[model samples]
Target: MLVLNSGSSSVKYQLLDMADGRRLAGGLAERIGESGGGGRIVHTSGDGGRRERTLPFPDHAAALGAVGEELRADGLGLDSPGLAAVGHRVVHGGTRFTEPTLVTDEVLEEVRALTPLAPLHNPANVTGIETARALRPDLPQVAVFDTAFHATLPEAAARYAVDRAVADRFSVRRYGFHGTSHQYVSRAAAGLLGREPSEVNVIVLHLGNGASASAVAGGVCVETSMGMTPLEGLVMGTRSGDLDPAVVFHLSRVGGLTMDEVDDLLNRRSGLVGLCGDNDMREIVRRREEGDREAAVAFDVYVHRLRKYIGAYTAVLGRVDALVFTAGVGENSAPVRAAATAGLEGLGITVDPELNAGRGGGARLVSPPGARVPVAVVPTDEEFEIARQAFALVGRSPR
Candidate 1:
């Protein structure tokens, strides 16, 4: 199965051998719509063979065509009978799509209709789906939504405190993003604990450029940080996660800023970038070490918000068997792990400095021996999860 995660100007793809769940090959095509400079695609095979090309890719169709050529070089072309299906990472599914579905014209339209909910993402997903469909019309295409796993959220948790009639008319409710990563990491955490998913409760914190926290009770999402969109979660690289909604009014009426300007401020110019001048954690940490007060405060705010979610979700889950961290910052930033879990001993969460600082590649516990609740760093595999869900939906087995 081929899992495609398409963005506004990039396409990330992986060909997986579903029988054993091994990635056969993968590649990325970036800067697709740029004008002067040519785009780049880098393909790598399981055996470590690599091929890179720099060429003009004016659109997704052109980029995907180049991707197909590279795959053919690896004897894993989309037309190959061994290729089962194409699984797409759709950002929003609204309140309708709750699971991976075989893509159809209606499905595409529905995805397009949901664009207003995911203005920056769903359109790119639709483009990838369309391009893949045109490339191999005979192949089955599947959509594994980032919001699907959070569909299990109950009414009390999903509904906003706005007017019921108005919210319903506008579909204003919590539809958490990063469901794929949360689902994968939660299950993986359960496995690390030597327990069945149904027997464990997990708090998964996916801290990437965009971040979100989820409370999973017995494999089902009970509450998540992101609501209705990806911008409502923890402090992110550029996005201001949780803010006073009236700030919009204040900015427009008092600050003399337009809605679009406010939107751009919150979505593009806030969070770590807003707090400190830098958004990258590594750079922020380096600056903090060099006595940059702004970076220190930014890191504090980031971890402060993170710790708040941890406490809130711990209360939501009652007994969190595993506090799992995943994604770029979650998996790699030792300072974040230590800081987020610091002083939470009463809540059965404590990180061992030695273990937390260790550079183990795979999922493993960072908590001290026999800690009340194990703190784990589980690497998220959304592509593999997408491929697994896609192949399962089509009832196709790998060769």
Candidate 2:
């Protein structure tokens, strides 16, 4: 399976053998159509060999052409008979798509129609879908939506408290993002506990630059932190999450800022960077160690919000068997993990200081022995999840 995550100016591609879930090859193409054309790509083969090159790719088609060439060099081109389908990461599925869908013309059009809900993402997704379909017309193209896993959100959790008529007219509601990561992490956590997913309850904290938390009950997502957009939940590197809606009105009416300005401020100018002029957690930790007050305050605010959600999700989930963390900061950044779970012993949550200080790549528990609620760091595999779903949908002995 070939999984493609298309952004406006870049494309991240991976070729995986879903039979054994081995990544045969992967690469990224970026700076597409930039003036003077210095598009760059770094491809990695199954043997862990890496190569980097620069080209003058004019558009997505050209960029993908280079990717195909790279794959062909590794003896795994797009036309390989073993390849079953291409899975696309479409950001906003709205309430329409609840599962991975085969990409038909009607499905493409519906995804295009969802642009208003995800103005920044769906268009790029549509372009990637069209480009891949055009490149391989005979192969199946599947869309694995980021919101599909959270489709189980009950009405009370999904709906906003605004006027029902107005909210419905504009399709305004909580449609959480990073669902693929949350779903992957939840099941992984269940596995680590030596239980079936249906027999376990867990809270997943995906704390990358873009962060979110989810309460997974019996393999279903009953509640999550991100809502309506990726910007509604955790305090991320750039996004200002969980701000009062009236803040926008205040900025617009009194501060004389336009809606676009307010949007830029919250999504681009806020969060950790907004707080301390740095977004990377490692840098923040270093500065705080050096007695930097600004970094200290930013780190505290970040963890304070994290602890709040941890407590809130605990109440939502009557029994949380494990607390799982994933993504960039969650996987590394021992300081953040220690601080986030510090003093939560009463909830059966306490990081083993010695274990938390150590760093390893694979999944492992950081809680002390026999802790009631275990704390774990499980790396998320969204690409593998995408390929797995796509393979299940259209992967019958590839033609």
Candidate 3:
């Protein structure tokens, strides 16, 4: 199976041998169609061989074609018979799509219509699906939505307390993002606890450049951090996680900022970078260690927001079985894991400092010997999850 995550300027792909869940090859095609764009593509094979090329490419089709050629060079072309289907990482599906869907004309049109819900994501997803379908007309393509997993959110959690008629007219409601990561992490947490997904309640914190938290009860997402967009959650690398709506109006009315300017401020110029001069957690940690007051405050704010959500989700779940951290920052930042759970001993949540500081690549407990709640670090594999979903869907298709 081929899992493709298409961004506005780049396409990230991974080819996997689902039979044994081993990665066959993967690469990225980036910098497509920008000014003086020298399209760059990097390919890595299963045995660790890598290749790269930089050249001018006009659009997604050209970039993808070159990527196919690179795959052909490794005898794993898109046309290979072994390739069953292509799975796409579509960022949003609204309330329409609730599962991995087989792409079709109607499906594509519906996804295109949903661009308003995910202006920065769904368009690229549509383009990727169209391009892949055109390239391999006979092959089946699946769209695995990032929002599909959160479709199960209860009305109380999903609805905004606003004028009902006006809210309905504008489709103004909470639709969480980072759902794929949340879903995978929650399930992996259950597995780490040696229990069925339906037997455990979990809170998954996906800390990366973009961060979000979710409360999963029996493998179903009941609550999530991001709402209506990916910008309303924990403090992220650049995006302001949660803020008063009045801030936007304040900036526009008093600060003489346009709506676009307000959007840019919240989505681009804020968060850790706004609080401090840096967005990278490692650098912020280094600065804090070196007695930088600004960095120390920023780190505290980030961790505080996380702890707040952890507590909120704990309430939502009612009986928390495990607290799991995933993604780039959550998996590697020992300080974050330790600090986020600190002082939560009253809630039966405590991270063993020595265990939290210990390093390993797999999911394991950082809680002390048989603590009340087990804290774990489970690396997320969204690509593999997409592949599994895509492969399962294809297997059930008519022969």
Candidate 4:
């Protein structure tokens, strides 16, 4: 199975040879369809040198073709019999598509219709699916929606407190993003705890370039940070998460800005970049250690918002059995793990300084000895999850 996670400006692909449960090869193409745009697609077999190339890729289709060329370069092209299906990561599925879907023309049309809800993401995903289909007409393409896992969110949490008629007309509601990663890591966390997923209550923080928190009660999604889009969550690399809606009104009325300008300001120009001129946590920390007040405050703001959500979700769950962190910052930033949970010991959340600050990896607990609730750092594997889901669907009705 070849799982393709196509983003707005990048294409990440993995060829999974499920016969042996190994990813035969994988690679990515970034900055698609942009001037001076070039990317490298790298293919690696287990325990060997990676084959890499740098070249121009003008668009998604061309980017995907380049991936195919690289796969061929390694003598593992898409023509392999082990290639069972292609799964795509679609950003939004609206109120429909609650489950992983096999891509039919009708399904494609539905994805197209939902594009307005995720204008920047869905079109690129749709184009990738179409291009993959064109390249291998016989291959089955499955669209694994980022919104699918959050379908379990209750109506009270999903609905916005707006005019019902107006809200319904425009599909204005919470459609939390990062469903794939949340679902994957939560399940993995449950497995690590030796508990049935049905018995666990977890808070999953997917802190990466884009970040969000999810409250999983009894193994099901009850609430999530992102509301309708990826811009409504934790302070991110480039995104300003969870701001007052009135900021928009103020920007329009006081700053004399248009809706588009406000959108650009909040989504691109804001967050840590807007605050300290740095997005990566490592750099931010380095600057802070050097007594950079701006970086310190930015770091504080990032963890402050995260702490609030952890508390809010703990209240929502009433009792949290595990707090799991995943993705780049979540998995790597031990300082973040410590600071975010500082003074939360009463809430059954604690990070052992030595265990956390020390070395090791692979979804282990960081909580102190005999802590009531365990804190874990589980690295996210969205592509692997996509491939598994795609393979399952294919096995049920093989193509």
Which ranges of candidate 3 are over 4 A from the true structure?
396-399
Q: Could you give the C-alpha RMSD of every candidate to the true structure, in order shown?
A: 1.2, 1.6, 1.7, 2.0
Q: How well does each candidate superpose onto the true structure, as a TM-score?
A: 0.98, 0.98, 0.98, 0.96
Quote the lDDT for 389 in model 4.
83
lDDT of each: 0.94, 0.93, 0.92, 0.89
Per-residue lDDT tens digits for candidate 3, residues 9-57, read: 8999999988788889999999988778688999998999999999876
Candidate 3's displacement at residue 142, Å, is 0.6
- Rank list by lDDT: 1, 2, 3, 4
- Residue 65 error, candidate 4, Å: 2.4
Q: What is the model-wide C-alpha lDDT for candidate 1?
A: 0.94
Q: Give the Cα-based TM-score of candidate 2 against the true structure.
A: 0.98
After TM-score superposition, the amount by which residue 306's alpha carbon in candidate 2 deviates from its true location, in angstroms, is 0.7
| TM-score of model 1 (CA atoms) | 0.98
Best by lDDT: 1
lDDT of 1 by residue, 280-304 (tens): 9999999999999999999999999
Candidate 4 per-residue lDDT over residues 204-322, each given as its tens digit: 99999899999998779999999988899899998999989999999999999999999999999999999999999999999999999999999999999999999999999998999
Task: Give residue 299's error in model 4 in angstroms.
Answer: 0.9
Stretches > 4 Å off in candidate 2: 395-399
